[model samples]
Target: MKVPVRKQPSWFQVLLILPGVAALVVTFLFPLLWLARTSIQPTTGHTLSLHAYARLFEDSFYWWVIGRTIFIGLLCVVITVPMAFPVALFLARSQSRWRGTLTALAIAPLLTSTVIRTYGWMVILGRHGLINTTLVWAGILAQPTRLDNGPFATVVALVEILLPYGIISILSHLSRLDTELEQAASLLGARRLQVFWRVLLPLSVPGLMTASLLVFVLAISSLVTPQLMGGGRVFVLATEIFNQTTIALDWPFAGALSITLLGFFGIFVALYQRILQRVESQS
Candidate 1:
């Protein structure tokens, strides 16, 4: 009787996936577990307790920072999305020559370091900087307006940094779409706007949601732009985390803040994924 032997799975497949799995576990999973553990620990003796979370709710300052962070994030998204749409459409639909050039230009800000970009904005919005000088020279204002180190300046810098993300995301979606579907819609007596609204918009929901969520998460977690632009006035969740960890030397509080922020952004991401999945199934 001849016995049949079962073939072993290839070692190459296991080798290929091992690095990614290891990286995920080491970088994200371990840190998240540590944060969760620390968040519940007592501040006094480093034992597990809910005191940090209770304290977070009791402290009005935490709530204030949370609300301000949300407000700024929404403002950034509102400004970035509409502005990026046309730019994304241009990059997606335009000829390769111009589209390539424009895409590079659009992402130029992202290529620059965040610190460098914020410094550039600082110059532009400073009292004695380009914007103020131009405004005064052109008689737009008699004196330099205090725009730097304010909510508006933070929003402006955040929007500039995150705008490229929205453009790139929507551009990827638009480029992947079938043009024939759009042509068919046009053939059915639809105008450019009509075709865009009826066909393009609905299909692009996943991408739009993705881009919005990206901007929202990035805006909320960001510290550098707010720190540089806030000038000690505006404080966000990330800044609070920084303060807790460094200035206050309160790791438990910082961990709680991290967990809270993670939960906040996690909800949005979950919602976005749910809606995106449903839309994908229907489409």
Candidate 2:
């Protein structure tokens, strides 16, 4: 029998990818192109200039905000990753009834609006809020402290908001993994912790890294959490972008800032992809 060559993909198959292609063009590509154009253009008129980028780089305040944004994003990821790991592990390994309840509770926050969630944090972290009131009742502190308007509180809110993503991502990986290897490791003299650290965690690194990337990107782009929790005391790149576009009425500057933010996010994603590819190669 002669082997036949496979046919090329039909037009329909090619067209099937159009919606995603169109969405990418409209949502991501167009904005990115516009931002690049605007960045080099003059602020007052349409004259081409690199003044915006030059001025942006020269300003210490802008640099500080960028640094703060990165710091907050990293802090949120660090806080969420450890907490989410156990929750994800539980969800992946637990019996049906408990798993269902825990999964729902973990994902319920994902369905809520960002504004509403930030407001909830506002209440919880307010000077006279539940935490402070409870602390006072317990006599842990002499007075209620201002936690809502600080970097720490902003990070806390971001952690809460992004925690579910980390759990869900890692949960999928953990759930899909075959337990036979782990069982064999345990049977052979490996402790439970050793099996987890060597077999389970190494296998789950891809998912964990993906979750961290998602959380970091979201945290970097977040506005409401920082705005509400920081109370104008702390400024992040996203909030600064909003202010530049709306309050300052400087689209060019805003676009430049957006381009810079996009550049940073792109660098992060590229680095993650490189690491992932290296891991895959090694494996």
Candidate 3:
């Protein structure tokens, strides 16, 4: 008997992906190309120059801002992951009837405008805001303190805003986990904490890494929350880019800053891939 032959997908099947490819090129690739071109081009002439990059590297203030941005991103990841882990575990493992409602509640903040949420945080963290007023009323302090125009307020608001994303990422991974593994570990005389640390936690590293990456990128790229909550005190890259674009009308510098931010994205993504590879190899 002759060997059976397999048919390949025809041109029609390949054509189906063209629209998506076109959309990606238009939306992502085009913008990236524009940014790259603008970053090197002179503000007045068509000639290319590294002046913007030179200025960026030469300025100590810009270095400080970059360091601050990285610090805030790391801090957000650290705070958001642990806080989200329990919530995600509950959502994933719970058999409660109200699970859907609880999940909705967890993500409900995303429905509201970020501007409105930032403004709400402002009210809560302002000098005469709820915390200060309650503290003073309870005789915890003599007066209201300035809380809205600093890194503390920025981090708090960012955590609240970014928490849902972390929860969602971790929950996605947790939901797919095998309950049998935990049961087997328990059967082997492993305690609940041990089972989690040794089995579940190790398996859940990918989700945690994804959540951390999301929160870190969002925290670093965030503009409105940092701007309003920082009350002009915070100077993140996003805010600086906005300032360069709108206030200073320095489009070339703005583009350069944008490219720098893009570089951060690329660096983190590479780091995440490396870590993920190691985790998978060990597993």
Stretches of candidate 2 above 4 Å error? 1-8
TM-score list, all predictions: 0.91, 0.94, 0.95
Report the alpha-carbon TM-score of model 3 versus the true structure.
Answer: 0.95
Q: What's the lDDT of the predicted structure labeled candidate 3? A: 0.94
- Which tens-of-lDDT digit does each residue in 1-283 have in candidate 2? 9899899989998899999999999999998898899889885766799898998999999999899899988888888888898889889888777778889899889999989998999999899999999999999999998788989889989999999998998888889888898889999999989999989889888888888998999999999889889898879999999999899988888988999999999999999999999988977
Report the alpha-carbon TM-score of model 1 versus the true structure: 0.91
* Residue runs of model 3 more than 4 Å from their true location after superposition: 1-10
Model 1 poorest ten-residue lDDT run? 39-48
Q: For candidate 3, lDDT tens digit of each residue in 16-78? A: 988999999999999989988988998897889999999999999999999999999999999
Note the residue pairs that clash in candidate 3: none
Which residue pairs in candidate 2 collide?
none
lDDT of 2 at 157: 90
Q: Model 1: per-residue lDDT, tens digit, 82-112?
A: 8888888888888777778889999887888
Q: Could you tell me the lDDT of residue 224 within candidate 3?
A: 95
Q: Which has the greatest lDDT?
A: 3
* lDDT order of candidates, top first: 3, 2, 1
For all candidates, the clash counts are 0, 0, 0
